[model samples]
Target: MTMRNCTLFYSFANYGLNKKGRRTGKATLIHSLRLKEQLELKQKYLNKSHELMRTKNEINVEWDSSLSHANLLDTPCGMVPLDTFTQAQRQQLLLDVVEPPLLSTVNTSDFGKIKSRAKYKLSDWIKNDSFCDAGIAFIKEILASEDVVNVQHSIYQFNLFDMKRKSQRTEQLVSYINAHNTLIDKPKTLNFTNFQEVLFKIPIVNGIGTDIVSGKEMMQTMKEFIVHFYPDYPIKLMLLHDDERLAHENTGAHVHAFISGQNALTGKYDLRIAQIKKVNEFLFKRDGMSATLFSETGRLNYEQAGDVAKHMQEMFYEFVNEHLFHPKNINAAFHPESVRKSEKRKQMRKEAKLAKRDRPFNYHTRLLEDVDSLEIKAKKLDDKISQREKVVDDLESKAAYLSENCETLIIKRDALEQQCIKQEAAFQQNQRRHSKKIRLEQEVDERLSTKRKEEKKLDESILLKQQKHTELDSAIAEKQSILDRLSVMATQALYPIQKMLEHMNNRLILKGRAGAAEFMQHIIKAFSADLPTELRKTLIKITNNTGDTELENALTRKDSQINDSFDM
Candidate 1:
């Protein structure tokens, strides 16, 4: 729009604040504050000649210092980092930007007291308990930390609204129109040039726009997401302008709808800074829950504010939860910010456990297992060796016994040879003794035969002598008897004995030896000697003892034999 159009847009906003009872028909307003809008206003109102300077100033602010540190690998929401401009940075990009009042904060308990009012009847009140909770949560989340806020910027690039991509911006406007789809009511009159112009001015947050988001509608959509999805944060909308090039193309004329962190109970950045101002002063005062909360955008009346806060809070938390508020980003969502801490303690404990595991043992586990196996095998081998040793001992005993038996056999053989030698010597001695006895017996038999022959011859000679001697003795004794008869009769016996002697001598000489006389006496003695020793001795002794007659006879025979030998 031209300069005159921008001034005219602001003029309608002042009129609504002054007239209490005047009913103003809905018209777009450029009221709410954006830090970017201030920079635009600074260029237009304050510096007319430094056009290049303003552009440079705006560009310098828009160029994010954060981009220098950002790694391309860094994804803001989830996948791709959207080029999210800040409120200050966003407003700085537009040509004719504006600033609005800061939001209000409310204490939660005050609303319970107002419930007694009939218009504020609890039954007619929307079921926004969960929605309020979601708003509270959204507020808490943005104010959680600086890093969390950075993530929130990336969220604006989602399907809902994206100023960077013209396609997304176009899509957002189309979707918004479809959601509240109004049959464009034929105007009572269409002023061909100014039909889209205001009949009655409607006060709005910042840029001129329709209530694209309805009050009842915002509450209904918000109740489900805000109450069910996120229930702690309160929602607020700020405004921004279009790029001058794209401005006229937009029909609804709203710049940007966004959220705030300051609670409505207090005029401070309650979630961020602390202030005593009550949230009600800035809020749209009316019935239903809307009368209870703040409205940075004039589009929401009492009901609309309630609904917008609820719906926006829902969308805010959804975006925050889905993008900015990842669970890994916080230690405890339920706790106050006071409870978070550094992780050094946990790291130290883990390191201690690892050190303990690295301590050495008495031996390696694998070596122990191998040693056990070796011991078992050695025992088995020892058993086999012991059995073999026993067998060797048994064989040695048998061999010892055999050696003793062999020695005994050798001794027996030697004894047998000695016994054979003794038997042969005894046989030779017995044979010699037997042969000597036989020779002695033969000599005795020869001597006995010779003695017997000699005795027979002597006996024959003696008989002859006795016969002859008897004849001779008888003759002699007869002659002598004739003579002796005169003297004695005994003389005749002596004469026969001499004659027998002479005959015996002759016979003895022929048969015996030549010396008969001496032989006769000797023969008698020899005969006697030839007889048995005992008988011969006894006869000689008897002859000697009786010497008278026997001696005379023997003397006579001797003389006769001597004479006969001479005569022969």
Candidate 2:
């Protein structure tokens, strides 16, 4: 559809149907014009404020790696004062300031007098004229430079170096070294000024179970020891390279406490070891409770230690890891105030960048686009309001013409009402029939649901019977197998008895034949000798009867008669 038709149709459906189309369109057009004016005013205000807002941004300067010297701008630029240069130019100049030399000796001409007054060794003191003629000239150049002094504070702050605190610590350390120096017997002594050149090592005592302790736990324990035992001394405890406990690994979670006063003397502090043992005995009297310390000689010779300077450097790194290492950022607890402030500024800048990224569009960008779009929509709405007003006028004219035919229309409305009444009655009848059909369908559904439940129950019963039948069949099969085995066993048991009975029967028959024949022969011969002719004939008959079956029967009968005669 055309835009005009779509707008008109929406107007007719929403407003024309309620007979308020013209009024609503006029009100809408007025509101749109007001909105356009407000947006234009807002746009003007934003533009004025934007013009007034002046932001100064700094360009970050990065130092060049060439450490040789600053590339000073020649002639015109170099002649200007350092303050006249932009911040970027100044930062570049600052990079030219090289690190100061490690060994800057001060005058120690009265070392002997000072040592006598303090009653301490002055062996480690920097002797006068330690720095040759060239060193003095270099020192003079640094002291004379006006730019160096002017930027000295800024340079220190940038490097996060607290020079005041550093100086104080150095003095204290020097005194400590001199005091302990008198106690050492070594010919070659440690220089307190460069005590950082000394090597230090802490042992993991097998008895103390240090090998099994966590790095953090061991560090904390060492801190506690220093706090309790040497409350006056400042000690920095750290944990490094935790892998020493394993046979293959040469590192473990061992605590290394860098005691600042340990280098006060050149020789190993045997006295400190004794003190440590005393602390352990005081705190824990148990046998395996003491911590041990290894000699610096062993650690100094090890491959990892390499040299005293490198070992000290590693110790510094370990200190940094313990004190400054945070998961996402550096911990500034030990940092100087100036460095902490710089860190805060960097964090704020990061957060601002994140906020800018999250915004959908800047307010200024939205304002410019909204001003143009509002004016266009307002103009369109005005034109729509005029067209709708014309349509409303046309509708009003049609309504006036229809007003003249009102009576005639009212008569036809009554007739239509009567027809509507009849239709309503027919609809009610149909509704009642539908209700009855719905009721019948509901009854049928209920019956079907009940039948389904019965069918499910019957199926379950059938399954149960089948299961029982299977079990019974299994039981019967098992019993049948047992009976068959028993029958076989009974037959096996009866076979031996049957064989013995058969053997006895055969033996009895043989014995009966042999014995009967022998007895009949003996009786017949003896009787024939003792008897007369008639008696001998009878005996012969008996003897003849004993032959085979007939003789056996006659002899048996005669022996029975003889046995009967003996009883009489």
Candidate 3:
């Protein structure tokens, strides 16, 4: 695959897929160009406005951290001046600018992967920041330079001779022939001169469940077999890779090359190399970028290892012939050095981008300060609201009390109105009774006056009648004296009686007013109004004088006649 430059895509901004299955590159490009110009214009206007957005920051200065100190070239989080952004531009700073990086290193790896991840903690740990100028200068110089060499380690071993017992001569001979042909590849002659001797261990170790082939038993068998069968010679050891985790338990196996130990079945042997079967199987295998191949048991293996070498001679041959060598020019691309170099350049570019991100404006710090101030003001407002509510409640209670008092006054007014009405009715009845009593008293006084006038007239008339009677008596006495002397002259006495009556009448003329009938008429008028019967009888008796029979008779007759009228 070839790497394509993506700078042209940014020119269109987003060359979206169209309905015709082509990129709408030209249309979008014109639109994006116009939008960019508009954004730039808006940003210019924004810068003029903010001039000074912050009214105060001194009270909230302690809330800021060490990063708040801004370099002119560094972006100091959200504490930047408001002039840096417009309404739309501000949204971009939060959603796009503050986001994490796209090519950042992952923290975990899959199985069999062999790359160093860019973990910050690991980098901190390995940061060799000593004041050692010599070591530091050397490392810096190496990093600045281009060419370098890499190194690795391996080992080999072989066998010396063959042996057989009398009873199993055929099986031992055949075993010796097969082992010599496979491991000890040499001249095809059946004689001992054609065989060669070296050392190697039988079992491969590490990442296996158990060790079935004992190195000690094999080493002892090989050593004794060599001394008895071939005698008086030495063998060297070989290794495929250097691994310290293996148990070089025996003194002779301490070096990763040769492992000399006793064999259980064979009495003795000399293992000249730690080149186990796992170390030799890489002869015809293919390996990948992470160095993947098969182990001794034919499962896959990876990273920092190759095939085993059991003998010095065989170990040397396998290295030269098993892998393709002798270089010829094919292509300059896809080389391991080239790939690694490009990865380094990518990391350098990312570091430069981060430097650009640390610009001179940030908005988070300003936002935090404003929020703190708002919270303080809100608390003060809450206290004022509580005080006003209490005052309103007191006013409502007073209004309720006043309303109740008004109702009580209305009841008292109604009662007073009822009392006034009853008194007026009583006064009207008393006035009517008093008017009737006055009329009755006036009638009684008129009756008393009339009775007194009638009595005065009746008493004068009675006195005149009494004087006339007295004169008539005196004249009669004078005539009687003369008649005695004239007894002798009798006839002449009758004639003198007439003359005496005339003289008595003339002498009996009395004083006082006349008209008794007029007096009686006035009495009747005065006493016509009803009076007590006892008072009426007393008036008659006073006017007639003491016990006058004529008057008493008249009174008795009047009483008797009035009683008779009652019966009728």
Candidate 4:
């Protein structure tokens, strides 16, 4: 597919030591006016459009202009002319338009400080001398330093291009850098110490066939291109769809991409724009997309920055008034209707004032009979006055009696109040005693409950121990039974060997010398056959003469005993 044609505009602004970056004191004024204009425009649109008026309560068109600045003029008032505004408004305007404030030193007090302190409008502290000096030094340092030759060395070494691709979401990229005025979604205060801003204009054009490229698509394509080419840099992107003057008067969008010239890893301001442009151009050609690239680099002074800010604000409001609140759009149709309504109301008020001014006055002329009537009325009034004097005297006596009764009633009320106070004190004392008694009873109940829980636990422990003792006793009895069985088995196993020994002794006594000799020979033969040859030879040497002599003598004694027993 043939890609969309685009343009890239690159520019940079240094924040230096100023926390406000390119934003000036005038930015405050422009910002306030922008908010007020937006509110007024939206209100005007709602008034004329019937559809909008139906859901007017649901619409959120309010702009908050409240400021911490003490001066009322510092706060935003919608669309009021400078000449018609109050004194406070005039002071606020001057504060923003004035030059950068001077620095306070030991030798000299800054003129701006004196004015601001007296008025309590020291909100422009960001434009002080220290900021200006640091900014100038930073610029000089950048210029004096040598151009970075091997800017791509680290990019290749770290293999940033091979890293996992980041999300195309613009918010993630914007979180890393301050975008300043390019971001129109919300008011962002520029507070970076040292930074650079770059702009890219990309016009959506028709591709092959009837496929038309949209502004958003163009913006996204440009974003991906930049991010892919400069993957290692801290870059941010913002798309401005309202900028219509691009690619030879064709209505198109522009992109603002801010890249920190500072190294992403080291945070050192060593990166140069040459490497960026080279990669951007190569990528554009490689992708077979028509693109143009341009760059501008510099630091803006206070007056210049203020002028630029004011100009930008003027453009912004013009765009908002013309395009955002266009007459053809239903949302913006209420403005004219509201204006007409206001004029009609004003005309009605004017006509009512004119009608009152033109009305005729009545003339009064008195006759003779009228004078006679007045004299008769005066006499009647005097008679009534005399009767009223009598009534007043009676009223004075009645008031005196009522005053005396009121004092007596007040004395009675005081006595009742004293009795009430005594009753209240007695009731409070009884309540306290009852509460104390209840508390002591609760404590006693808690102690009894705790004792019962402890007794239960001890009883359970003793039961468990007794169960274990019974198990141990049963195991000991079982072991004693097993030992008795083993003793019986051992006695039965030894009976046969004892009987064989007794038989051998009886043979030696009954058979005399021959039996003893035959036993000795059998013993020798058993040792030779069953024993190892070496052990058998050792036994023969040990028992050769001594064993035979002992056996024969023992046999002879046994034979003689038998003979003696027979002769007896």
TM-scores, all candidates, are: 0.15, 0.16, 0.13, 0.20
For this target, which candidate reaches the highest lDDT against the unseen true structure? 4
Q: Write the per-residue lDDT of candidate 3 for residues 1-568, one digit (tens) a residue.
A: 3421110000001111122111222222111112233323323222344333422232122112222121011133422323334546534432232121221112211210221221222233226433334433432342233222111110000111122232243233233333322322211121111112233222122211113223333334334433432333322221111111112111112111111122223322222111233234333333334443334432333432322321222333232222211111111112245753697645743443331112121223333333344334433433343354334334333432332232222322232233224323432443422443354335434533543454455455655545545644444444433433333222122212222222222221210125433433343333321323553464345333322234346545655556566679
Model 1 lDDT tens row, 426-467: 324434235533553464356446545544555556655555
In terms of lDDT, the poorest run of 10 residues in model 1 is 191-200
Candidates ranked by TM-score, best first?
Answer: 4, 2, 1, 3
The best-first sequence of candidates by lDDT reads 4, 2, 1, 3
Candidate 1's C-alpha runs over 4 A off are 1-59, 65-311, 318-326, 329-568
Which sections of candidate 2 miss by over 4 Å? 1-110, 113-212, 243-251, 262-568
What candidate 3 gets wrong by more than 4 Å, as runs, is 1-369, 402-568
Q: Candidate 2, which ten residues in sequence have the lowest lDDT sum?
A: 4-13
The backbone clash count of each candidate, in order, is 44, 8, 56, 3
- How well does model 3 score by local distance difference test? 0.29
Over all chains combined, what TM-score does candidate 3 have?
0.13
lDDT of 4 by residue, 488-522 (tens): 33233222222222333333333333466566544
lDDT of 2: 0.33
- True-vs-predicted CA distance for residue 264, candidate 3, Å: 53
